[model samples]
Target chain A: MIRIKVRPFFQLKEILKEKELTIELTPDSTVLDAIEELTKRLSPSFKDAVIDKNSGKVRSYYRVLLGGRDLHQLDDLNTKLCDGDIISFFPPVAGGNRAT
Target chain B: MSGWAGRILLVDLSSGKIEVEVLSPDLKLKYLGGRGINSRLLYEGIKAGIDPLGPENLLIFGTGPLSGTLAPASRFTVTAKSPLTGILGDANCGGGFSAELKWAGYDHIVFKGAASKPVYLWIFDDQVEIRDASHLWGKTVPETEIMLKQELGDSEIQFAAIGPAGENQVGLACIIGSNYRGAARTGMGAVMGAKKLKAIAVRGTKGVKVEKPKEFFLLIEELCEKIRNSPIYPRLSVYGTPGLTTLLNERGYCSVRNLQQSGGFEEIDKIDHEALMPFFVKSKSCVGCIIHCGHFFEIKEGPYAGEKGGGIEFGAIGPFGTHCGISYAPAIFKMANLCNQYGVDVLGFSTILGFAMEWYQRGIITLDDLDGIPLEWGNYEAAIKIFYKMVKREGFGGLLGEGAVRAAAKIGRGAENYITHSKGLEWGHADIRAFKGYALNQATATRGADHLRGIPGGELLGIPPEEAQKKFGTAEAALPTSYNKARMVLHYQNLCTLADALEICKFNTEIIGQGIGIEEMGRLLETATGVAMSKETLLEVAERIYNVERAFLVREGIRRKDDAVMGKQGQEAVASGPFKGERLDPDKFNQMLDEYYQLRGWDKKTGIPTRKTLEELGLNDIAAELDNL
Candidate 1:
């Protein structure tokens, strides 16, 4: 088993019961597998925000980064998980900055 | 001049004269509109070393060609010699006032010289009047608007007014419009008040027309739909900017306790968007703004319940709430209302109060210094009392009204140490030390320490490297720690400059990045103005406008040294959190700045636009003026 940490940010943080978590997962588990496991542990909003219910593809605005690099850069959802890995999810967010 | 009225209303308050002059086409084409024209006029009309609060300073309201059109989020630019920063003061506010001003048949309204007594400019269609406003003087923004509306017998008359803060010539006072919206930075209201002008009330029934109505409608519809379908569109409609409180808080980049830590205090939970949900009334929007990000807040079920009003923008939360350790969103909401009503810039007031609280905690200040009112952290009542004192310019407030720089100078017991400012302007919210590109943006910003001048949101936030790479050359620009900021800063500054020149909101372009692209903007221009300009041409205009602003400051004796970095930004590390041990490296920053100056085609030594660069940009006259300097 490999232990990895996950952090949900912004709008998703408000919904997720566990914000930052370190959990043991099966060795060589792909990012998709980890996301699926975490999805079960998270609220419905996370499911709706993270995954396209029909396509199963990450939404355009959604970004999942591992070790300060995007998961898409490594291997999309198939990137192999490693021990002591850090995964961060940035949900869709916006702020009006000096527009007025 | 289908997109423009081709007219400028010049009001000489000293002579009580108003003249309608034709706007030169060459000036409009060369400078663009809105901020571009305003800055050019200020550069040419006002002299160097003039007192910012004196009658010699000119106050201008400039609207872009697209402002009164169906273009989404089009705003107006307000320009004057800033009393706070002692340089070219420019601010943009979004609302219907700008559009109405355009429809009233003018491109710019230039106010020069001080009135012999208190007066207000009244504009209705082609008729403009200087009316006695002695009775309306010394009133809050809302009160002044109400009085003007009642007297005019027109509920639709839009107003831009000042309050006691401006009447006292407080350097941080702002000119408020359509109630909550304000041209808030750099003491524009103080300039207005110094002119003995209480307000400007405009009502226009003439209506404006665009070049291609059908094409314009289609483009606007497409842009509006883009705004509606954006990922955060619904969120904006529901929570507005207050929704961002939780977002910034979670990022470990919250301007917590005035840069003490990432997220201010342990009770920071009480200051998030959820904290304000209980007090939420509804979301508000300006005229023609599809992304309605202004939430109407009311204090309900709290100590201040039943106090209903608007304006608790995201920026206000940092200063009035967490930055000062005040977690009560209700009281903070009320404070925002007070600021809006009193026509004060929340940025300056909050900085002063936060500085005072920090000094108090450090044992450098006490109740004895404040006439028995202790300025402890989270002391909302004490803050409110001080705010009122500032508006009235009473006792200690008299000194504080001079803003953080002057006040810190007067209370010279190492008080300036607490101020994280550059160019005598207070740094709002974001700790630039945590965000490197933002540090460069703030440091090099012509308007002093400000973020909107060039928003590095895409790079600071976690945008995919591929996405960021497409615009900024390399993905390295995406990191908050990377020193590859010149290109990113230049790109966004050009975008922001275009937005300001066209008087469009930056949210669709800078904040979200995908909502409105350069191609769409280019198309919008073609369809509206029949100008047939490309994105590159627009960027050229933006660059020229930037140079003019630089030359204006250069004439005022600003240089590389005056383009000073904020205090402690590059010197010290943050106490803790993700940004811990992260401060700007002096050597890296110097190299980055040198590269930035090279990219801007400015003199690296003095940070001034070179004569060759200015000449290439079709600003021959401005180039000659700077050459003379």
Candidate 2:
């Protein structure tokens, strides 16, 4: 098992009811798998805040970062997570949109 | 003329002469409205080498055809040659005032020359008057609105007024609309003050008429639905723009301590939107806007107990709190309120404040030079005191009020090295050293260093490479560090121009691309005006507007040399954050700029639109003028 920390900011933090959370997942779990675990542990509203219900993927405007690098710039949702890794979720602000 | 009020009001304040002219159809089809028409008018109205504060300058207020209709977040643009930059100057403002002006049966109002005494223009339907405003002079923004409402005997009358900052002709002055919204950049208020114009109160009863009311209404419904369903809607509606603070800070884009460090402010959370929620009263919305991204808040229990206002965007809190090293949320709010009351541009004020603090720290400016204000970082009390004196143009604030560039010139002790600016205007507090697209945007923005000119959001949004390629023609455009940002910046510049011309809120357009794209904008325009417009034609018009503004800047003597981000942004690497040790590569920046000019069909060498490009855009006269020059 690998332990990874999930940090939510802005509306996501409010929805998750915690500024930061640590959860255990299977070794080599992807960012998406961690997100699934978070949704199950926290509220389903966490999925609503960070994931697009239609695409079953992270919403484009919403941001998910692995460590300090963007998920897209790294390996996106399929990027493997290791123990002690940090994943941060940020809801969209006034900046432009991302394609779904 | 169905969507348009179809009249332009020309007022010569020096002679107190007012003339109403019929709106030209050709001009409407080309310029569209708002900033587009205003730019064309300003280009034709002023002469080269004329002082911006002199009687020769022109001040124009314009609203788009969609302004008074069901268009979402309809706004206005005030345009004049900047007393601050001495080039193309304009600012977009949202509030109740634009709709009121549109309902008064006018598309544009042009004011020229200076008044002999303090005066305010009053417009009510068909009646217009230039009234003596000696009694209203030297009033704060809210005070001016209150007095005007009392005198007009109409609580619904909307006003655009300047405060003591403008009255004193401070370079940071801005025109305040409805006491909350401000045409905040390029010193539009200083221009008004230079003309001795105190305020403009407008009211109208005639409603806007659309060509195809049913079609327009249906399109409005579709657009509103899109905006509501957008991912940006909920959070933006809740926190307004201040919500971006933490995200930007985390990304290393938010400058801290005048770019000494990027996003290393330990007290960032203390000033983010969540911190301000306890003081929030209610959500505020401009006319015809569904987002309602503004909020009224009061500092009920602190030293700023009685302080309350609206329209405090990211520009205010981010700059005052993080950039100036002030962590106290209430102090930021108090300074924001003070800026609104005094009709000062918060971005300009905070930029200069950050510059001054850094200068003092570097020993470039002494405590004696600051008039014993200490002028230290995180000193909100001293900052507040300096701000008050800035509005009054007193003591050390007198030099600071002249703007950072001029102040640096006056000091002349290598103070210029500490400034981050473009075209003599201080940059809005974002660390552009790490983001090449944003760097190019700020460097080339016609109205000095401004992010709103072309905010490159793809990099920060983490757009997928495939999607970025499909949209911007290159996957590299999605990365903030890549040199292929020219295409993205050009597209965004056109998008922003379209939003400004259409007088729609950028939140529905460039700011959140999901809300309204080019196709929807074209449909809205066609349905409202009965003009046959396609997405291609809309893009053309947007491009035309941008070129016109560029031509205006070029005529004002801007060249490739002037189009640059200077000071630390150009010289030094960002000190800390995820993108720490990153700085703009000169070669990459030049390559991006070259590509941007090439994409715009401008001369890459001179950064001017080629005659062929101008002529193709139906700006033959401008092309001829440039050729003569």
* TM-score of each candidate structure, all chains considered together: 0.93, 0.95
Off by over 4 Å in 2: A1-4, A15-17, A22-57, A80-85, A91-100
Instruction: Point to the candidate with the largest TM-score.
Output: 2
Q: Summarize candidate 1's per-residue lDDT along B531-609 as a digit string, tens digits.
A: 7777788888889999999998898888987665656454567766555777778888889889999999999999989
Model 1 stretches with alpha carbons more than 4 Å out = A1-34, A42-60, A63-90, A93-100
Q: Model 1 lDDT vs. the true structure? A: 0.79
Worst 10 residues of 1 chain A by lDDT: A91-100
Q: What is the C-alpha RMSD of each candidate to the true structure, in Å?
A: 3.4, 3.1
Model 2 iRMS: 8.6
Clashing pairs in 2: none
**Per-residue lDDT value at B621 in model 1:** 86
Q: Could you say which candidate leads in DockQ?
A: 2
**Candidates' lDDT values, in order?**
0.79, 0.86
Candidate 1, residue B604: CA error in Å? 0.8
